[model samples]
Structures are given as C-alpha cells and as structure tokens.
Target: MPYFSRLQERPKIISKLYSNVITFLTYIVTPVLLFVILFAEEIVIVLFDTSYSNIAVLIQILSVLGLLKSFSNIGGNVLIALGKFKVGFYWNLIWSLVLTLTLLVSLQYNINLTEFTLVVFFANFASFFVWHGIILKYINIPYINLTLRFSLVFVLSFLFVYLLKSFIMFWPSQWPQSIMLGTYFSLLVLVTAYFTLLLLKNQKTIIFTLWK
Candidate 1:
C-alpha cells in the first residue's frame, strides 16, 4: 500500500508515532551530532581562549539556522503525517529557497553577523505562519488558538528565567564556574516549575509527553 493510504487508514496510531519519533530523532539527535562534528575545533579553541568571540558568533549563527531547519522539517513531517504530502514538499521547498536567497543576500551585502543572525531568525519564524495555514487546511485545526495558549505559558516561563538571571547578575563576580553553572540550572528549574504550574492551572492538553 502507498504511504498516504497507510496514514489514512490508521492516522491516530501510525501518524502520531511516526511524527513523534521522526521529530525527536531529527530535531534532537541529528543537530547535536552535527554541532559536535562541525565545531569540534572551534569548541576546543574557545575552551583554551576564553575571550574568543568567534565561537560565540558561530554559535549564534548556527543556533538560528539550526532552529529554522529543524522547524521546517517538523512542519513538513506534520503535513506528511496528515496525508498532505504535496503541501509538505512544496512548503519545504519554498522555505529552502527563502533561506538560500537570504543567505546569498547577506553575503553580498556584507551584513554584520549579528544582523544576519536576526534576519535568519525572523525569516524562519515567518514561515511558521504559512505552515500553520497549511496544517489547518487538512486538519481543520485552529493553529492560532493552540499557539496562543502555549505562548502564554512560554512567556511566563521566560519571565521567570529573566528574573532569575537578573538576580544572579547582581551577585559578586568572584563566583566559581561551578557556582555559575549551578545558578543557571537553578534558573532553568524555576522557570520550568513556573511553566508547569501554569499549564496545570490552564488544564491544557499536554501534548509534549505524548510526543516525547
């Protein structure tokens, strides 16, 4: 049987599992491995030379690009699982073209690395709107409604993180790296706790565990 037919037959089971596994492996594992391989040398240099700014710049650039590519793949995979393969293919193609053009233009104009990074991030985020429309076409889902609910929780979490960071910044600078790392993790915990409480209060369907 063709792939689309299989999806149509058992969408809730097959599609969900396929989408979840592929998303985890592609968005998580592949990117980590790629970063390790691509920047091994730069990472070592940064460890030895703490003042190395290139590594930070490289990280900023890669982080945005990685997010863009990962989300593009995710949107495509979701469309495929919903048995809208053509929409998946076309949108992915369009996103790829947009990224390529943006990259070329950035290079041509000699744009500052920070500005280039921001441009790429915005471009990637812009595609999500289009992807949401495509997802709704077949699923009849209100992407905006879902996004708003999640965004509320996300904003609250970010606020917690910001507050924690601000508090830490006021601390004495003589703190050990171990102490700094602990502080960072503590902030993460606090933000996560805040978000968890908000989610429970809102009683939103927890799709993250299902996908995980």
Candidate 2:
C-alpha cells in the first residue's frame, strides 16, 4: 500500500506497476485458479480425503474470486494511496451488504451451498467492476488494454489446460500422481503464457528469431 504513495512522485510508475501486477496476476495466479477450478475434486480428495469432500465445491466457489479479489485488493491499496478511501469503503460496504442479505435469505429458504456459492461469486464479480472503474479513473489505466491483456491470458490458460490434459492421459490415474502431473502442466502453462505474451507484445521471438 505504501508503495503506491511513491507512485505519485513518479507518475510513470503506474504503468510499470500495472504491467508487473497484471503479469503476475495473469501468468502466476491464473493457472492456479484454473487448476483449482478444474481439479477441485482431485485436490480436495488428495489433500484431505473423502471425509471432508464437501469442501471441494466450496473451495471452487471461493477460488472463482481469485482474480476479482486480486484486482480489488490492489485497487484498495491504490484508493487508499490516493486518499479515495471513501470510495473503496462504500464499494466494499455495498458488496458486503449484498452478500449478507443473500446469505440471510439463503439461510431462511434453506438454499443449497452451490446456490450460496453462486451468490458469493456474483457479489465479488459485481464489486470487481466497481473497483476496476476506480482503477481506470484514478490509476489512469486504459480499460481496453487491460481487458485485452487479461482476456489474452484467460484464453491461453484454457488452451494450455487442454493440451496438458492430453499429456496427462498417459499418466497413472492415482490421485497423487494426477495432482503432480497437473502441477507440472500448470507450470508449463505459466511458461507458455509468459513467452507467448513476450512475442505478441514485443515481437521478440525466442530461438526462432534466427531465420528472420
């Protein structure tokens, strides 16, 4: 949070910070999100056994907020630095109220956890847009570019997952083995996204730069 204050004295740092933050969120955090989303069963079963199996769904639900939470957290720091603390407070309040009301209704109606999970997702999803708007307004980030970059990472993560699935087919079907293989593939996704972005954004080829 304090690092954001230094950004005022050096306005250009905003772009750098945005770039680094997004890259970390994309290539680093995103694969973990995708992995957890896709392999919640394996993860929970392997880590905690079938006794607590119900938690897998809840974990998946909460993990959906990974990206949104990342953006909101960073935005919170930025807001505080800019002394736009009230805006952050209000947005958070709104989301909290939404979740609280929805949760109360769910409890009253005996809603399933899946339904409750969707409610949680929606609250975070909606609050993200509000925080994102603040980012565009105060942080000077262009929404178009940011959206495109995030979308690019999103697309590539799915692609990598698909490819990794094919390779994982040859591996043993044991839960522990599957988890290990999935992690290796997850790391590959990060590497592939990193280099792919470099090529797209900088027009820099890896070893293939030779014949050009």
Candidate 3:
C-alpha cells in the first residue's frame, strides 16, 4: 500500500524502499544459499540417501538459480509496478532466448546432465545482469549499495561455514560420536547467530513491510 500509494507523487520514495527491501532480502537469503551450496552433499545424503548421490551436484548448481530467480522476480515486479509492462516482457523474452540458445548449443556437444544444468545456470546468470540493468533505468536503485551488502553477507556466511567445517575436521575423532551430528549442531548455532544479528541490526526499520 505504501509503495502504490506514493507511486504517482513520490516514486523516488518507492524506489528507495524497494532498493532497501531487495538488499535486505539478499542479505537474508545469501547465507542460506551458501549454506545449501556448501552442504549439498551432506544434505543429499541425509535426505535421500546415497542412491541418488549424484543429485548433490545438481542441487548445488541449481541453488544459484534460486538466487538469480529471486532478483529477477523482484525486478520483474518493479517493472510491472511502474507500468513498464513492455520492458518486463522484453526481459523475459531475453531470458528465454538466452536459456534456449545456450542449451541448443550445448546439445550439439552431447552434454550430460551436469553440463546441461551448467548451461542453463550460466544463461540465467547472464540474463540476470541484463534484467537488473533495465530495472536501474526505471528505478533509482543504489546498485553499489546492493553489491556491497551482498558481498559482505556472502563473505561473512562463507567464513562462518568455513570455520565450522575446519573446526569439525580438526576435532579429535573421540570427541564426537558422529561428525555429521556435530556439523548440524554447529551450523544451527551459526545460522541462529547470523539471523539474530541481522534482525537486531534492522530492528528499527520497516524491513518486513516489503513482504506485505
């Protein structure tokens, strides 16, 4: 309501609000994305057993797609909100063409499942930048701020996970009955800490309003 209410009289306000929301969401989700990517093997093993072990790689790869889609979806909504429906259509068309053409080219080489997935992932990644570039023309988003926050979150999450992994690997085998149990406990703690800090930092802001 706030965004639409001010759409005509104060689009600058809407743009700022939308940019902040996107940045906040990126911070929140990037950690989870990193967690999933880093532990894809363990996750697959725990959830589906070793029978479908090969799917772990796919999960890790597609995890990136999830992040890209989040940004692209938000960008699409921004275009629509601004009544730039034609721009949104062009963005989608470009994405489709990128994915289809890349897949077709890869097929010529008789690519396997993993290779095929990579082609699709790369195509989305390529188109993501294009979509966001179009979005910038319509919305006064702080692209640098978004990039910096995303980089910071990504680095912090990666370091936390890496340290957790390192500690687990170095601990005496006799200390823990199961390494997997230890990993899960440590990850839970770290994830909790991450979110706790994030919430505390943004507590004064109307960050959650982005969802509504």
Judging by TM-score against the true structure, name the best candidate.
Answer: 3
Deviating ranges (above 4 Å) for candidate 3: 1-9, 172-212
What is the Cα root-mean-square deviation between model 2 and the actual structure? 6.1
On lDDT, the stronger of 1 and 3 is 3
Write model 2 residue lDDT over 78-191, tens digit each, in one string: 667666789888877887888798778777877787887887788678768867876678667655776787788778776776566556666655656556755765687668
Task: State candidate 3's TM-score.
Answer: 0.81
Ranking by TM-score: 3, 2, 1
Q: Weakest 10 consecutive residues, lDDT, candidate 1?
A: 24-33
Model 1: how far is 84 from its true place, Å?
Answer: 1.7
Clashes of each: 0, 0, 0
Please give the ranking of all candidate structures by lDDT, highest first, separated by commas.
Answer: 3, 2, 1
**Candidate 1, 22-48: lDDT as tens digits:** 333332334343333344334545455
The residue-level lDDT of candidate 1 at 84 comes to 72
